[model samples]
Target: MLLSSAKLALQDAIEASPLPDDPELQRNLSEYFPAPMRQAYKKQIDNHRLRRDIIATDLANRIVNRLGLIHPYELAEEESVGLAEVASAFVAAERLFDVREIWEELDEAAMPEATRLILFDRAASAMRIQMADVLRISNGFRMPSDVVDELGRGVQKLSTGTEKLLADESLVLTTRLQREFASAGAPEKLAAKVTHLFDLDGAVGLADLAKRTEIDPRKLTNAFTILGQDLGLAWAQGTAALMSPSDVWERLLVAGLARDFQQMRLEFLQRLTRRKGMKDNPCETVNAWLDENAGAIRQFRSMITRARAHTPVAPAMLAQIASQARNVLSR
Candidate 1:
């Protein structure tokens, strides 16, 4: 028979004769009546009290699958209900269907066990998909207002219940800050100190942290600059609004000084080690080496001290090197 002829026949049969609520009967109907004819049967039963619940269950499945809801088990209880409400709203708007009646039928224990399970599973899947999409778009960051607004209008509109799933801006910023600090090789002690500064109520200031941690102000500023550059200066600056223009100059000066100090320290250590084997009196050799590099060491210390007030005149590593050299000479 032609598909249209089959549809009309199914419709007439559904209205005139009650169909058995059996899976086999449903399969036989599909095999004999054809695919297009099934929808015709659905439409015919749209008003029929006997099969309306079945039609709603099928419609619910279609709505959820269209919304990309494939995983039902992952959604929370509230999320699942919110998704169902969204599906119910869409059905009322687009299909002129009464989801309330479907819920009523299920509540009144009139809907078949099989149909109820299908509705529950589909609704759960839809909610999971909706929350997943919100997270995906936010990218663990504060979603842009325009994007949020646009999402509110898109197919899976953000209803009042689902809006809570959006990422919190401050939380996202804190997470990114921690990640950047770790990436910048900040020591765990230093990173924890900096992170604690952010956790306080006000804007994080580099100078305030320098005083609190007793770290060199220039080093603190340099660390902040590295983090800011890595995470975009605008975002980092927004988080630490007290950053000043002088911080940029301090970063450059600190970077150059650190590099020069490291190179000089390496050369001095290498020369001392080589001379230890060459000379019998280690004290003589050590004094000669110190005398040779005294001017360079003095210059480095003076430059570092001038860069930041009240900072240690020389880095602890430099002081440690001197201590080690003195111990060698004494031995």
Candidate 2:
């Protein structure tokens, strides 16, 4: 009788309590809240009747379906329990519905426990599916689901074909370069041959870092294509000077090094222009930059020299120094 009376009392309280209609409060609070908070608030408001257990069960079913476990009977009770726990944790974190947020959260530095890792993997899988759908729509590709399969074989094939074409072009260019440079008494270095093609003699040593064997031909093609586009736009606007294809290729190769050595490259270029008093010609500018930055190169070499000098010391201290140097060099 006491339990029955308590249940009746709880039902009466729930029935009496209506949700607060506070649009003004929501608006005011949302002005100060971050995007994730506002999204969570909206989701909770829209689905207040949905219990956490129901959400967890739904998530578990979706996960099993994604994993290709078609029969419900294939999901053992023990496995279902773990899935429910992971889903419950995900829901509690307010990422049950926001697939993008869930994906980003998975990139946190600290390692997650097993349950959270499973949750993250499910989120990542969902994100991949979303991206695939977007790509299909943008590319206007149509394929039967069975033919393409879940791994998107049709898209993979398109990518592989494009890569093969670019690789073949690179091989042709390599053979032509080998013959032409060998005829001209060029040093056997691939960088020297590529640089000498545009009369850029000074940067041959630094260009060695970007080995022809390592760089993709597609990347080089894209770089020159962008340069052409920019030059065309400049010509239309009558702002920048027109450049020959060879001159632009030299500039593009030197510009590519900006990614690995931004500050040094920029300072070197500025100082070179000041010293050489050159304008509107990238080939001349780059050659001058290389000549003027010799001191800076020597300083950089000195830093590496110091880094290589490892004196005998305690094992623990030496290990720490080595690790630190490794991090610096890798950067």
Candidate 3:
């Protein structure tokens, strides 16, 4: 309940664009917010310009989610979370021109470069998702499950949320390409051997990518969130043939996503279990990690495909990508 409340408060803060005064806001939320929660929220707010930064993000997500359930053949690009990648790029410009369309009204200041880029990427992504490359390969493809049946083996697992600046930037660069290529709808788009601004192997960390590409790690992080959600598959629950796509996706995918999402979420717990910091394997710590991370490993590893089109990963990233392959098997 506290987590739920805290999450709601954070989302509200993002939407309303207010800096919560620890003393005043915390006191106001006193009935709903606990002391510990106030302290934590304050510390985070103080630590990062998170409130200022989220200004564009909350808006982008808002628009992308609005354009849902397009024909699989359309391949429109939505934002990171939605199905599209190409059209997502354009949505930014469209939103800029149509300021009064969604928001109450806007000053020219509203369509900053950051906001513009985000919306455009989301709109383009909408187009890409419509294409649904995997689903499109099959003729007379009538169902999402068609993908689950064939080439399910071809799907790749998304890596856990990493906090690296270079990796973050690379993802940002790659995601934009995913949108563009997704619009291009060529086999080489998601595949390797295509030249892009950032190469998968060009840099391995946020710092490196930022230095080389001039993209700040902090900015890259937000873009990364969108990219991960976009590139990541949406396998929600399973609906009975009697069920709708929404039902099947929810029953099937959400559990797996949540299972893995939580697994990596307990990062510190996982690190301890591996005994990475100890001089030798502390059997106790090892057991603790296994006890905690085992389920995540199980659920997570099962969902990876080990390969995505054209893209090849180093051993570590490849292992990370393999989860998609496994999800198909179990499902």
Candidate 4:
């Protein structure tokens, strides 16, 4: 494909080359041409040849890199000589990174099936054909099916371990711990725990928090301390508006909602699977699925509603948390 493409490109360049200024003069001389006219033709042909060589060299280097034949940086020291060398280097490179990077590259390139098409569009067809052949040979050198399966199973086990951790009552423990700190007059730790607990609940997970929070524990401690100070100031300024026993109870109630919501979602999933034969997936059967779990859903909703009804300090409390977040972020 690449060789044919190169031939076509040369043909197009030759066809587009200007004939003599006067067509009749050129026909009179038959195939013979003046020196200046011949020079012009030779210059145009040379220009096309140079361009083809540059493009071919670039395509060759990319093929070599993709196959893991050579590092891109090393191309300066060890350049491919021609199309055949590019093809040979590609085969070698595929083996070099076969375990990981090569597979990842092919996967990103949408390989095995669509790889040929993707490569053809990117480079000359000769280069694409060579790449496709190298990829096929690389497939034969892949890890054994059993080893791949074992790796897949190991991944599944790690995922299950994560899910088990999420299912733990650790949130409840942390919430109680925060309240204890609050009661003990360690508002900085209390706020830090609150921030930490919420961060843990997020998709970012605990590992990220551990890496980030430990970097400046002192800074975080100060932010929460300032937050505690601000809350005190807010309460001093508007005690009747911001402070209430019910507000504390309401936050506790809100914190517990995370656990309840997780349970409710799991229950819905279970009911959904059991009903799948009779109904479509949630995309089409969400209302019916909800209807089946209406009682449990209603109970969870009532708890949230009750919690909100008890949360007397809304905008004021949210403002405090926002202030604390800004303080921490600024630090």
Q: After superposition, how far is residue 208 of candidate 3 from its true place, in Å?
A: 25
Off by over 4 Å in 2: 1-268, 271-279, 292-296, 308-331
lDDT of 2 by residue, 150-217 (tens): 22322222223332322232334446545654564433543232322222111211122112223232
Better of 1 and 4 by lDDT: 1
Error of 1 at 92 (Å): 11
The TM-scores of all predictions, comma-separated, are 0.19, 0.18, 0.24, 0.19
Q: Single out the weakest 10-residue window by summed lDDT for candidate 4.
A: 201-210
Better of 1 and 2 by TM-score: 1
Please report the candidate that would top lDDT against the real structure: 1
What ranking of all candidate models by TM-score puts the best one first?
A: 3, 4, 1, 2
Q: Which stretches of candidate 3 lie over 4 Å from their true place?
A: 1-245, 248-252, 255-259, 265-331
**Alpha-carbon RMSD of each model:** 26.3, 23.5, 18.5, 27.8
In terms of lDDT, the poorest run of 10 residues in model 3 is 234-243
lDDT of 1 by residue, 123-163 (tens): 33323333333333333322123232333232222121221
Instruction: For model 2, give the RMSD to the true fold.
Output: 23.5
Per-model CA lDDT versus the true structure? 0.34, 0.30, 0.32, 0.32
